[model samples]
Target: MKVSEKWRKVLRRQPRYWIAIIFLSLLILLALFAPLIPIDPNQTDVANMSAGPSLQHIFGTDEIGRDYFIRVVYGGRISLMVGVLAMLASTIIGTLVGLISGYFGGWVDNVLMRFVDILSSIPWLVLVIVLSVLLKPGLVTIIFVIGCFSWMNIARLIRAETLSAKEREYVVYAQFIGEKHSKIIRRHIFPAVLSTLIVAATGSISGAIMTESALSFLGIGIQPPVASWGSLLQNAQSSLQQAPYMAILPGLFIILTVYSFNSLGNFLRDVTLVEG
Candidate 1:
């Protein structure tokens, strides 16, 4: 079937998936093109402090008189970037670790799986908070902390998928032909598990975004002068009664973005299970 037809079929089968896809796409586009807009997120207007939404300021001016709309737009850029990069980092680490452990099995599997278990035993938020406190707070540090610690689940998932994939006919044939381990994994095992990986990765994006937001909300993720959805919420807390929209707008975006990714992930998981 043509790719377009396949998408149509999938959308027809699960109509709500279109909502998730469209919302996510629009958010991504807005974040990407925010630079083309002329508004400065941090530029303050002394006369407009805590202004309500109006024609001049759709989202209104923040406590310090900064444009709330532009700040939210720029904040999306930060939030989305963290989500995507963190997902990529976790996926790569998880895939490699899972592949090696599953393919080699025996002692290698025992060691790696045990390590994963140990990490999993720790409360993720506590660990992230401790690390955030120890290290300097910034975008790169936040991403590194989230990406490194968040891979345990993905590794477990990929390992299980790889174990089954390696037992498949094509994988057995490749082994019989003396194919290199890496080549066999790349060509056979990886492809077999790709759908599962994609689903896990999609879910991971929302997790990462939430993690970033939580850390920022606690005043440990992205610092001042730089706006993020979470940091915006932190800033709006003092003036919440005066300008509730300041808190509401960013919180709404965060909820919707996370929900959209989760919806898409659920749809992918359902489709992949059916295909399998």
Candidate 2:
């Protein structure tokens, strides 16, 4: 038991865990204190336009001389929100469809699976791009577009998990004891599948961030005055010959953020599998 406890502590205290925690901590801090930060993200200094990184403007000024660092920080907040809230929206939708389909089976399962199949047939990025172009670009629009299409994969994963879990004795006993469908789902099946759900959700965040960036890159995502990492990148395309920093700074942030999420998701998948 002493050895078991020691192993448990070691498992929980991985170095990658510290890195994920620190990355997420700074992201949260940047978002919460964006307005209070010293730099003016939107205010442009015409004289300083296209300046490279310096103590005066740490991440350098963009073509319009806005503070790149400050914009990137705030863009982190917007992109993070789209990833998180959109994933939560997808989770709720996918979990419900999967639970009902897997628990009841027969015709219900067929219908839900077919719906997911139809959704999966559509190219997700193309669909989002079309939708973003049609709906007018904004934060909420991006979130909606992402959540609407991203739930199918989660639904399939949850359905597979539920099929296995329903055969387990606890689930059988719960049904035999006359527990409600919702109760069984909330209590028994959810806990069984939740570890995988967390990993899927973490991965979804990275996907959503990339999708939003792509949309912004195409000029159909979050609009100007309101920044996103993708929107920040858009500014540099025209000035690439003269001001490459416009593209480089936010591009690095996007890469770092996505890599952090991917690494964290892999770590969580391994950790959660061990726990299960």
Candidate 3:
């Protein structure tokens, strides 16, 4: 069956796929239009500091009386951007390294796999923290650091898949047809890898978000004045006793977003397995 047809069939069988897509889409839309939305995330009113949720501010005001709702909304943009861009970076790097290692065996495979193994052995969070210390904490640094650490799993997964796929009848047939190595890998192998990559990308998004948030919470991520969910939570930490909602609001959003991505990734992985 065509991949698209199989994908459609799988999606039809899983209601959560639609739910996840819809929820994530709404989040992306909200983030995309956040700037245009008539809400002042930064405008503070000391008079309203520590206020509870009201009709005017459904999420209430922070310690400094900035509209919590707008801050959260803007925070979503940073969180989502970090997650997506990091996922892309990791996926591309991992996919290429895996494809190369698997498609061409011998020393290439040995060296690459050894490097991956060494990376995989390290404590992921610790490694990220160290990297964060070495490089200045910013959007780009967070994205690249998270991606660099995250790619090991993807590399191993793709490498195994490629090793198995290279010996398949279709691949052998392509080889027999005198196709160039690159063409065979791109045309035949890549399609198979693409399915797994989609699942990996989705999973990576959740991880990236979590990693970025954790770093930001530790004051090594998106800096002050930038409203990432992590930074928002950090800002609220001291005020937790006075304004419990300060911590709860952004935390809830982070949990929900991560859960949504994880659910979507699992659904895609299951569907891809069935397709295979």
The candidate that wins on TM-score is 1
Candidate 1 TM-score, true structure as reference: 0.97
Residues 161-234 of candidate 1: C-alpha lDDT, one tens digit per residue: 99999999989999998999999989999998898999999999999999999999999999989889999999
Give TM per candidate.
0.97, 0.92, 0.94
lDDT pick, better of 1 and 3: 1
Sort order, TM-score high to low: 1, 3, 2
Better of 2 and 3 by lDDT: 3
Q: Which stretches of candidate 3 lie above 4 Å from their native place? A: 1-13, 273-276
Q: What is the lDDT of candidate 3?
A: 0.90
- Deviating ranges (above 4 Å) for candidate 2: 1-14
* Models, CA RMSD each: 1.3, 2.5, 1.9
Order candidates by lDDT, high to low: 1, 3, 2
Q: How far is candidate 1 from the true structure (C-alpha RMSD, Å)?
A: 1.3
